[model samples]
Target: MPAIAYYPPLPLNAGISAILCAGFLFLAFRKLLRDKKRGKATLSITLAAVFAVATAGLVVGSYQQYVVMNTWSYDFRLEVQPNETVRESLIVPIPGESSLLAALHLIAGTANWSFIETIHGRGLYFQFNGSAGLDALFSEFAPGGAYHNTTLTMMNSTAQPGPLTVWIFYSGGGGVTVHFASGGMVMPQSESIAPGWRLHQLLFPPVA
Candidate 1:
């Protein structure tokens, strides 16, 4: 597992970096106007450039981390029925804390499955099959870039009874509260689709 990162808030570091960059630039201008020697003015300008680069690095790195951490929680419900009177079921939970790569590997290992990846336009899809009896589909928008939404489906087979239904939940801070259905009831949809996914696609569509 990759170590979780800890850093000061991006806005806070950005504010400080901007202040330092501006201060250095102001000093460079003052030195150029009042001092006869060019060396002091050149040094101040160099420091300003260094801070400017640092500020840009901070913004870019923070945005990347934000995208990775912005994921959803999934509850996979698998159901198998051998006869009209007998039913068997299994449930797997994939928390938001796990990276998408890790989650895929985990599921494959648990079910003895293999998968193939495909890219269509802006979407990435993974089709998985088990040696004994299982088949699944996984998909996400913009795999490594900004995350929007993900969907998974598993079909039932004779060896493993299933039409696995996955319920997705989105929340801020990666914390989710899942409600399980009981007594032959179905889980309610949080929405027709994830709100964040819809908003992101609307605001930042791929350029032609």
Candidate 2:
């Protein structure tokens, strides 16, 4: 429904856009020359336009991938205290769904790391880790700022235990704390102590 964005502010994105645009224009001119030189059927300008748009898409996608690789890191864990079982999922969001979700959650120049969905249901607990690195830059949302920190669909989700506590730790050294908007819950944050930041010990009840 909305238009696709080619982020031209970031050097990485801008460079790709410039190159793709140049290539597309070059192709158009070349096609024009061929049409004149051969004196054959008129060249299809429509096809040339489509090819240019496709090239732009490819360039944008590739640049997105490069951004994700150097930006975010995630560590997800599910611990069952009663059963003494723990499951871990560590993911580095590439330029795909995960990274896209992270991009959606980005708070511009403010927060770096953010959690998408942390819910307890069907006797299982789920949590996800998403973050923007210091080097990560933010472009204005395609539509407007109305969607800032606001999401239409959940980014990432996982499940483990119902009566579980979700702990999210963010990188970047400082006296950081997890500030909850739904409720005024604050968890002391840290960069790295000998033990690292202890997120919180939340207790959840099993779903009926």
Candidate 3:
């Protein structure tokens, strides 16, 4: 039901685009049939075909994006490596874990986040789609230690990008969540999430 309420519904948007495409095609057909003027008929036909193809392409593109990031969330991972030093400080533009989360965030609309912070230094766990991807993302500590591997997840439900864009600060520790939801399970504004979530949050935290 929640997912259903989400804007830019696949079927509806695609249907509308398809109709426009078909309308252009029909108009072109009528012109072609009414007066067999090569120049005019050719123009109409070309336009109609372009509109139809474009609309259909939109449907296909939207569907593909939906399928890939339907119920998705962005994630970042910071490895609290040995010596309390954060690794991967210098993130390149290459396709790393962050890249995946960045892409997912843009596709899901920029804002509408539910921040869940866990003060516990417990090992990080995650789930991608249905399978457990990042089981635990914590390095061994010499016993008592602070939260070296912390996750800052910015989750949102109303992320609808105009054409799928780029936002790096999205939520997820388990990877991009692409599963549909039946409501409930979202974190409150003031609460913290724990245990296992197939989401990841990664970015160089401000070092002291």
Residue-level lDDT of model 2, residues 1-208, one tens digit each, is 9999864444455465556566655666776676553222123344446555766776777677656545433322222111112222211212222333333343322222343333321111122232212222244323222223212122124545542233343223332322221111112331221123233333322357
What value does the lDDT take at residue 88 in candidate 3? 14
Clashes of 2: 2
All candidates: TM-score? 0.37, 0.25, 0.33
lDDT of 3 by residue, 43-128 (tens): 76777677677778778887776555544433332211112112111110112222233322212221222212232211222212
Candidate 2 — which residues are off by over 4 angstroms?
A: 1-44, 76-78, 81-208
Q: What's the lDDT of the predicted structure labeled candidate 2? A: 0.34
lDDT of each: 0.41, 0.34, 0.35
Instruction: Report residue 162 deviation for candidate 1 (angstroms).
Output: 25
Q: Report the number of the highest-TM-score candidate.
A: 1
- The window of 10 residues in a row where model 1 has the poorest summed lDDT is 195-204
Residue 8, candidate 2: alpha-carbon lDDT: 42
- The all-Cα superposition gives candidate 1 an RMSD in Å to the true structure of 16.4
Q: Write the per-residue lDDT of candidate 1 for residues 105-153, one digit (tens) a residue.
A: 3322123323322121122121212211222223344445545233332
Compute the lDDT of residue 106 as modeled in candidate 2.
32
Considering lDDT, where higher is better, how would the candidates rank from best to worst?
1, 3, 2
